[model samples]
Target: MDDFRLFTSIRYDPELLKVPSLGFTNVGWNSKSSPFHMLDFHRDRMLRAAIYWDWTAAIASISGQEGLENLERFLQGATKDLVNGPHRLMITLARDGSLGYEISSLPATHLNNLYPEYLPNQSFDSDSNISVTVRGGKVPIKDPMYDIFVDSQRTTKSEFTHYKTTFRDMYNDARNRAKVNPGDKKEVLLLNEDGYIMEGSISTPYFWRNGKWVTPPVPRKFDAFQGSGGNDGTTRRWALERHLAAEETVLADSLVDGEECWISNGLRGFICGKVKLH
Candidate 1:
């Protein structure tokens, strides 16, 4: 697991420049066999149960030596929480050996928080997560960790719990398929549906042209294309200071061009600088 074990610097107090070698964990690949169709997720909750163990292990690892007692308490209870509560990976900012507050999930709906950017020497490829700036040295934070996008249904479908299906897996799976450029030591990106210009895979894409940024025109009539009130082009809403994108009739041909390409998925938003295709 050397590939899993990373050596890096962490910043607890920037003034002090305290960079500890922390361990961040990602879940193993979700069983892709479970297609996120309308009928599949509810039919099979047990199959997705493995993610619980993965989370527990990661929680323990994050609290290296000086761990967070309160957060650690929460992780200890996760096993019990899994059987009775909702299933999702947790993100913690570990310091010393203790963990930080907590970020529940990294679904496409909230990618802007990461503030992803593109670097020239940095790059991404398929099946390879072009090393983004993560903290710690254990698993590479696997799929579904922070790449899920949820859609709520209040007075809608009889089965509104479908978020347990559609987003959790699909969001991360797309990043799993991306490629990386070996030459750039700092090059990293996520590869979802958003094209090269797109920064996020599950969320959006970014392209640099004339020092300007552009995202993809969302697919119209998409499976999850609900209105703004409900679940619409979630990828378009990643950082929406102003909502410029919408569910329109766009084709694959429209993705190319743009100086540098990026994908903005759950864990990483506007991930510019990809070296591979979907």
Candidate 2:
């Protein structure tokens, strides 16, 4: 789960973001060759999602450019029938108003190019022995990794928290901590200074507590808690809109009072597993 560079950035390619001329449409796929494929028109959805999170400032600041053009370019290259496959698209923005993005599929096989021994082994398979670790206390990153984790929820927070910048120090640190325990894939559940369960390292945490499902509140003020800003993911939005979940502060002490818990991200919807807090 340690984050590392997967693909090098391409200088600038508009053609890479174009939709295929004869491929999947909103109604259905162009070909029946891939029967199990699903078509999701994500370009517009992605742009709207970014704007909702107020992350389009950098793109807007650019001269004669709309914020969504780059995302269109990023999705244009995903013409393959592997829509159901575990692929990840990353959009990174620099502090200097520079933007970079990459779209790539997760390798079918596990490959550890860096930090091979930094964390315990975890199965890539989704359903196998999934769990999450509750941070025993306020865990802050040291020296070089300090900025990797967002210590504040304010607009001035780390770029990683607001946008998926090229920073994975917080996630990597969480994975390392999870390795101390045993599970197929143990994520780190970060808590705020008030001991409220905020989010997982790479996911938004949800719980069924007090007869309703709720997600941790989005941090709006400066808090010493690291990893405060949860990604404004599509799944989170869906759950909120459909009345499936409400935004509320989930205290760590109330975790045991929940009926069940799960984590979600844009790439992967609700994970079908629970976090064992022992």
Candidate 3:
């Protein structure tokens, strides 16, 4: 059962990450109506992976209106015990449609402060119907940065590299190989056998190239012998949707030492950082 469950982690905050195209906002912690970063995008990504893996029951658990309602209910119940603050909400679904979640507090990020042009304004319509009882608080103001490292070894691309799941042995092994010291604020970027930079172990990599933010292209078709591309991360999707970043093939050799770049995940939005190539 553990091996069959699909999962995703998302940012749950009282402050909304607005989505004007949706015409309605998603419920967030403590807000009567708001957004959960890129909730729909995350759901769609998981749904696609489920379809690819032929997990019919898992697909049904996260697919349409019913699934959305069920997810809201689960989140509402799970967040009842939470305190007023932003959180990292990790949700998992079983093959039998059972849902589980874990909530952890997160320090505020400088996403809006660092990239104001890319972030949407915090606006919500009073007519929004979605509501939840989760607690809310101010977004943290402490800006944290990370040190990025290029892995010395190349990883073979596979379904695990392209999808977000519990099957994380490859990623774990990559991190282990890096031998990072405890409490190190760093991420190890993995490369493919063909020398294409894939992604960070737990975040999406965005390089500043030709006067624009460019991320490694994620290939739709998986070729065992070719690069599997990187995971289609929600943060990357958000950046691409807003034209804040472009998708291009990034070669490991192209990375410049101490060059400014960015990395992101569902928990943290766009983060400014620098690269360290081996």
Q: Rate the local accuracy (lDDT) of all candidates.
A: 0.27, 0.41, 0.67
Residue-level lDDT of model 1, residues 106-137, one tens digit each, is 22321112222222221223333434453222
Candidate 3 Cα outliers beyond 4 Å, as residue runs = 1-4, 17-32, 111-116, 119-142, 181-183, 220-228
What's the lDDT for residue 130 in model 1?
39
Candidate 3 residue lDDT tens string, 1-278: 34656788977765544333322222222123543656666777778777877777878888897876667777777777765668888888766667788888876654342122342111321221212221231121213556788888898887778878888777777788886553467888999889898898888988767767788887554546554368878777767775767888898888888876677788776655568765
RMSD values, in order shown: 16.7, 12.9, 8.5
Q: Rank order by TM-score, top first?
A: 3, 2, 1
User: What TM-score does candidate 1 get on C-alpha atoms?
Assistant: 0.29
lDDT of 2 by residue, 64-174 (tens): 325344443434544344444345555444333344555665422111110011111112223232222212211111111101122222122343443343456665566
How much lDDT does candidate 2 score?
0.41
RMSD of model 1 against the true structure:
16.7
TM per model?
Answer: 0.29, 0.53, 0.80
Candidate that beats the other on lDDT, 1 or 3, i.e. the better one: 3
State in Å the error of residue 81, model 2: 11
* Candidate 2, residue 246: how far the Cα is off, in Å: 0.2
**What is candidate 2's CA lDDT for residue 11?**
16
